[model samples]
Target: QPALCPKGHYCPNGTRFATQFGCPEGTLSNGVGLQDASECELCPLGHYCTGVGIHGAPRGPCSAGYYCLRGATTRTPNDNVTGGICPAGHYCPAGTSEPIDCPNGTFSAATGATDVAACQACVAGRACPTTGRTAPGAPCSAGFYSPLGSA
Candidate 1:
């Protein structure tokens, strides 16, 4: 007798065993007897699916300091995880699928900053020369002055 395959798994016709094939990574199945790979749904947005045989849910949410789009296979893509590091001059809040650029007149020195608050305002007398500045750039080029938050 043939039985329905379990969630996260698929059994093709003439299959001898239900677990003969597990759904590939980046996808999940919530119901039993998934017959084809297409039955496995892509991991939902803001989530990552890193493990094999994921049945009821994705491996987990994309970790902090990172973002995951739909079907993300890892937490952060920059050697540490999967979805790709929040680039310089940008911040990524929790569950963010994309990095948000720091507003003008602000800058971030770090790459994994998690919030807009991480983008520091240009200090008094210093000019943030660019959109994504690691440090308040050259000191107003001597003589010329800038107020706080100057870009």
Candidate 2:
């Protein structure tokens, strides 16, 4: 009486006239059959999985100005590597890893800058009047003046 036993239940060998069978322990028997369970897999690069048994869920990637470390399981928001973004009042040159302060008289109009060229300099005939001054239209010193008022 093989039909007497439910699917996934184990039946002893040579029991053609079996009337009872026991389900295996430590295994799932959903009335289908015995099968192995799938294991969790690591997320691919640029993607992160936060939970177990994640079959198909959207993953987050490192945003601009940020980098993911090797074997990273979680990412910090707005976190950056040692050479990620240019420091305040500094510029990160093309293809370089660190930020550099703009020259004495130069000033960066924006933060997180990438190049020295973006730094605006005091126009000719106008003076910075002081060190680390950022405003471009700073009036000229006593000895200098913008005759043309060009900026």
Candidate 3:
């Protein structure tokens, strides 16, 4: 008889069945009956909604070195939680959603790096130019030499 609540599941208010409730993790609910649960939606930027209900789709992306951000429930983000990894100098390749600096010249103290050859160059005397440089820069001020990779 009473229909509705379908999209990702959600009923409430005298709800008889209809999946009772699902949309949880980062959120989704494409819309159907959705009674409460904030209506569900988030889980966008970078993606990672591992609620196992919404179905709206999103349990992907945010892998490589790591980045995510938005509602990322868990795709890699570590240290504590909520989009992390790929720090030092930045790199994040694969599904990387963000953090991709390390450009001008080249530098990377190392963290998650996934692309750009892990940014290295610029070392001879140190220069780096600047972009996300984790190191290499406070050494070419004597007579300005810079040779190795410079930048």
For this target, which candidate reaches the highest TM-score against the unseen true structure? 1
What number of clashing residue pairs does each candidate have, in the order they appear?
A: 6, 0, 0
* Candidate models: Cα lDDT each: 0.79, 0.41, 0.79
lDDT by residue for model 3 over 31-122, one digit each (tens)?
78778877778787776887646665787887888888767788886743568889898798756767889987788999988888998887
**lDDT agreement of model 3 with the native:** 0.79
Comparing 1 with 2 on TM-score, the higher-scoring candidate is 1
Give residue 110's lDDT in candidate 1 (0 to 100). Answer: 89
Select the stronger candidate by lDDT from 2 and 3: 3
Candidate 1 residues 35-88, lDDT tens each? 898888888867888876788777777777787777788877564334777777
What shift in Å separates residue 55 of candidate 2 from its native position after superposition?
28
TM for candidate 2 is 0.34
Model 1 lDDT, residue 4, Cα: 85
Which is better, 1 or 2, measured by lDDT? Answer: 1
**TM, every model:** 0.74, 0.34, 0.43
**Worst 10 contiguous positions by lDDT, candidate 2:** 32-41
